[model samples]
Target: MVTNEQRESAFLWTLDLLNEGVVALPLVSQDFSPEDWAFVFEGLPQDLRFSLWKALTEDKKSSILAAMRDDSREQLISLLSNQNLEDVALASSTEQLVEILDVLPKRVVNGLIKKLSPADTEELEDALNYSEEQLGRYVNHDVYSVNKSASVGEALAELKLEDLPVYTDSILVVDDSDHYLGQIDIKLLINSPKDTNVLQLAEFSDHVLAADMTLFDASESVKNCGRSMLPVLDKSGRLLGRFTIKDAIDVYQEYYEEQLSHMGRVSDEDLFAPVFTSARRRASWLGINLITAFAASFVIGIFEEVVVQVVALAVLMPIVASMGGITGSQTLTLTIRGLATGQLASSNLKALGNKEVRVAFLNGILWALVVSAITSVWFDNPWLSVIIAIALIVNMLIAALSGIFIPVLLDRMGIDPALAGSVILTTITDVVGFFVFLGSASLLLI
Candidate 1:
């Protein structure tokens, strides 16, 4: 079997027309990387750049935009005529268009903005209105919706219309008031009698999401139900638009990137932001984290006497604290993930929490035995082992409880579990774990 690399080579070979020898287009196209494209855009004659831009397919053009550097994107955008820009804009999603807009000159963005249809422009504006993390920021309003009374043939005609988005999966069916009726699978359209009404052909078994549902909520529904797309509905039951799994995937990727940056204590910054602009963005979040860490340190200060008196307490404090923190983090991570994925809900919360409690106990026992043995051997004191063992068990139990409680509480308080969760979990485990361990040693070992 050919490897992916080999398959890509063959695929490139098939696009040989896109790489003719004259003008050395083959050499230029074959070795094209995003960075290379940026360089090529910088060096090429204006006329040549326009010629190459016109020659590329929409898919290829989108790929080139995806790869192009920030500054280069503006030049490329300027090179494309209004018609070309509109095509590229429509081919891309609202998020992608916004990203390109951020880099392109305001005039170019305005020009392209004007070229998009009223509906497409509405999508861009709606997505832009919300901060990137909100539910509205990632939705695709270009979703296909049809009236229930239309025939399958009519639905196909609507789909075939150049202005409407081409979708291969399903078309949302709405009543006269645009209230969601159901969904008609495109596959059913293929096999149905052309005269069949769309309502008759539609599957009423749609899982509609609310318009204001978070990106997390949207992603969870898509993941659990395994849908290509889900219809978003208003409280009044009006059909909003289709939420594609693709959009959710894009949101997940963006969030994961943000999380990775935050893990390094950096704020989310625009890729094209100026150095000072990036620094300004980074500082605020880091400052917040610094303040939080100082608070944790202050809690540690209250027990400093305990720590100094029992040097062994200092030595072993982090062991118990780290264990609780890590275990609590594990629970917090899983619980937040479950909530995000819609696996843990009020109905099943008890069962899920109980399972986590059992898991914590089992892990606690195993680690407790290990710590007890190490303490007994190293200190040559069986009693030290007993204190450490009891501390571990107590800390682990608290870790398990805090893990579930913190996220659930934050969720109820309308706080983002992603942003505030780890902080809360760390604080709880640290303060409680240290107090439990050192207090145990003070009360029992002494």
Candidate 2:
């Protein structure tokens, strides 16, 4: 068995190979995890990284490209020469090519498109015409679709004339005008008699996607249908292309990454990006957070007179605010997740609000009793305990309501709920918690 020291030595040697611009594919294939590959790629110098990438097989290249974050992919693409860029673009699938093009400058993208064949150029131009969030931008244009009136024999003959599209499990059926009809599973087609009409064996589905549909909506359709591929249609019902399960997964991953970046208040940046580039990307949100923090502090400034009158109010004020902030954060996270996953809708808003309020009331009563007992025993003051307990219950209930509404309202305003929701929720909780606790103390205790 290899000792720990020996294992460390082997890992270091592998990393050294990557640094020296050596082809380590055989070793990487046998020993490295996907994460290990990512680590090595990240550690390599720019020139060496490009060399190693160029040496990878098409499948390995695709895997690595998919595994990389947007920033890393963009950095690598920027480092390539025009010829190298053209070669890489030509070698990739329609989906992969779109991803590569997304990071490049518009001029570079146009130049690369010019290098493509006439058919590929047209398809790429079509994809470029759609907005980034639209399904048309990512659909695979290189798909196999036969006329619906064709016989199974004719379909088989067509398949022999050209290679099948990648990741295709079924042949799409279309009309003379290129309107989508349905799909025929290749296995079923193979089993049926050759003279049979293709339409007779076609599996009609109502789950066709529209080219202008948002990626999120298209992914939902793909998931609900559970098909290997879903055909895309234009506004006039003409066939545009097809979206595969792989494409749907890519969309989901992109959406998830965007949400994560938004929550951190940072755009996705390369791990090894230039220091200033990374800082600039983060500075905007940090500035916004600073402003919101001041807003919370201003609310606390208003309660100074009450705090001076009763020292206990100052000591216990944070407890009320902290608890409210935590409770609101829980609700905020859940609501944002529900929105992202399409699990929550406007139709359920009233019902969801009522449910959350009920939960908050129950939890507030239980926790408030515990805190009140502790405060009474410590301070020898029942009235103070009762006041704090009431404050807790009130703040918690408001926190729950604010948490549910803030994200939904922001979403309707075309703002990202995950990015702004936490900040807004914190401000509300702090202001309300401080005002309720201090206002009550000024009236009763002070």
Candidate 3:
């Protein structure tokens, strides 16, 4: 409920009071509120601030650090000794650990791995290495699991006896080899007869996903299956971990980030990453686009002579090319989306292509009629209208074919259709539209 400005003023006032020798700073530090701590961290010199950061109670330190920027997080980590870092990490929750690691430099990340206890490091490492779009990234390793043969009484006794994690609610049932058998909801486990086997009351088969499955796919499965936590398994069907709703949400966020990056022609790097590192990561893709653009320009240069002879031909040429390019892009976009979703397949390609071509043809005919009318009115020549109409029809058909086929061909050739499809589509539409329209105009109109 405390505002940032109030927090800041308290921090600066505390510093002023400390400088005045009004009280012992360390004892004063002990009484400092979380908001007051946030203000102090933000107001202090970098070195002294991080020293205080390293000295705070683990929970307070985590809460304070969470409010700080990546630079501050990095500064704190840099100030810590290996032993100090290990102690700080051990006392932190999984959420806090992820937050710290998300901002830490890769070198600092590598160091933290060494600092953690072997068991803790292994658990953290698994989550760290998981694909950003995967359920593994969000799945907590702290879930409780029991054997399928365990009775409800046994499950309850286990829950009461063990130092169970705070967040665990349902006790998962697993085979001897740790394959997911089912999961007993704590409420069901409590209300059922003590003699009932845990497996009898649990729902398992319908709430599981593969380890390598994308978070997007897992989220849809979770929505359809109606469960809070879905078990993740290996190819051998051994239980690996459980993907929670939180993990599904994280995956969706990662996808959204990737989409935003793609729109800006940037590589999907972490937002918390260093600016120079992200710039270096994006340069290669931008370079590739640059090269492709020049290649397209070179193709246009081949017909420069025709452009120089008739200025209007050059002016009107881009109109036909742009229309065809737009048509091709619309078709290509749909095709790629369908292919990614596994909707467009060999069995349906014929029908899908036919539908697209028919749509393109109808669209093309409508535009061609409009352009022909314009040509007749503008040039006062019916022959020019006829030539433009013929060119329009031919270019539209070519655009339709190029849009549908190029990406399919690229997909078959094991290339990323989304990456290369647009450039190739534009090239085809441009070259074909220009040749058809301009060449026709030269013979028929000029």
Candidate 4:
């Protein structure tokens, strides 16, 4: 088997061939997987990518396209003929086909829709009816099964006539109505009495994903249930398809990518996209940050006289605000992670919030004392030292509570917590920390 590092090297080697104006297709049989080809395809500059793509056979194209990211695949997809597009759709999962169709021209979609068999059309339409996050959208239709009442020898004979499905740990056993009942392992089927019923030899399992279950839930279930794949069923328990380990892995990668994008308040865009396009996508977030910065500056302006009376306040204020910002970010990260994993439920939410506040309060008291000792020795003003200590404790308490509440409130209002939570937390901590420290000095020293 090719290791990931070797697979990565394959793309570099193939790109070397391309730069020399050499044909790239001959490299397909050189132990590099379609995934490696996908990397090479995506790595190529857009102008040169399509020329190499046209050289590949449809089978090669289909496999490589399956492994490529959506943006890169769509670039080549637009150049494919109707027959090639049809073949791609047939090879894709329900959700993938729906997304592919979304990008096609209206005329092309109409033509493509007609070419699909009635069953294929229904499945595609059915998949589209669910939310993108739901399992119904991502179901793999390439499933193999056997009737539960069939004899073991007959079932074994049927397996010999056809190829096994993807992630075929066992032959799923179903009834005449296509209601999933159990599974018979290939080992058991071969070793069982020839005349024994498949149902008698089947391993019963309730592990399944409902069509409406979110992909994240399905991923967690797949891990916890100790199964690499599970039967996907409708509300009526009729087997719709299979949710395999590959699907679970896709869900994980997608969630990680989404969170990374949301953290920067930026679109999940291609790296080699136009400079203007990437700039336009990022500029809006920068503008929002500027607005918040002005708000923070406005707070400092309110304490203009407080700072002039004691220039040390200017030097020490940042120390207070920086501490609060770091502390709040730590809490916010935890809250967002919990929400993503479905771990922050009603029963545990209040406890988590309280525990965070207690942790913050204790750390505040401990660190404030340490800062006060330093301030007393450096400035030789006990009053300034006391004021800074009080300010630290107050700001930290506020930071902790804001960290917990901000994410919960944003989620309730249908906004992504990871996207805006850090921005909002930073603004609050800066403004509040500055206000508390300077306000105490004005009241006590002025």
Best model per lDDT:
4
Off by over 4 Å in 4: 26-34, 75-96, 300-446
Cα misplacement distance, residue 365 of candidate 1 (Å): 50
What TM-score would candidate 4 get against the native? Answer: 0.63
Would you give me the overall lDDT of model 2? 0.70
Question: Each model's TM-score?
Answer: 0.45, 0.58, 0.46, 0.63
Alpha-carbon RMSD to native, per candidate: 16.9, 15.0, 17.9, 14.9
Residue 14 error, candidate 3, Å: 16
Tens-digit lDDT track for model 3 on 345-390?
4534554566556655766676678767865665466876777677
- Residue 127's C-alpha lDDT in candidate 2? 81
| Residue lDDT tens for model 2, 97-199 | 7776766667767777666888777777778889988999877777899998899998998888999877788898888998878888999998889999998
Q: Can you write out model 4's per-residue Cα lDDT over 118-206, one digit (the tens) per residue?
A: 98888988788788779888788788888887999898898899998767777788999989888777777888999999999878777
TM-score-superior candidate, 2 or 3: 2
The alpha-carbon deviation from the true structure for residue 388 of candidate 1, after best TM-score superposition, in angstroms, is 40
lDDT of 1 by residue, 292-401 (tens): 54355445556655554466566566667767766676567656754553334453455446655666676677677877887676557787688878887788778878
Write down the lDDT that model 3 would get: 0.63
TM-score, structure 3 vs. true: 0.46
lDDT of 3 at 96: 56
Rate residue 361 of model 2 by lDDT. Answer: 71
By TM-score, how accurate is candidate 1?
Answer: 0.45
Clashes of each: 0, 0, 0, 0
Arranged by lDDT with the best first, the candidates are 4, 2, 1, 3
Where model 1 places Cα greater than 4 Å from the true spot, the runs are: 1-95, 99-116, 128-131, 156-167, 269-446
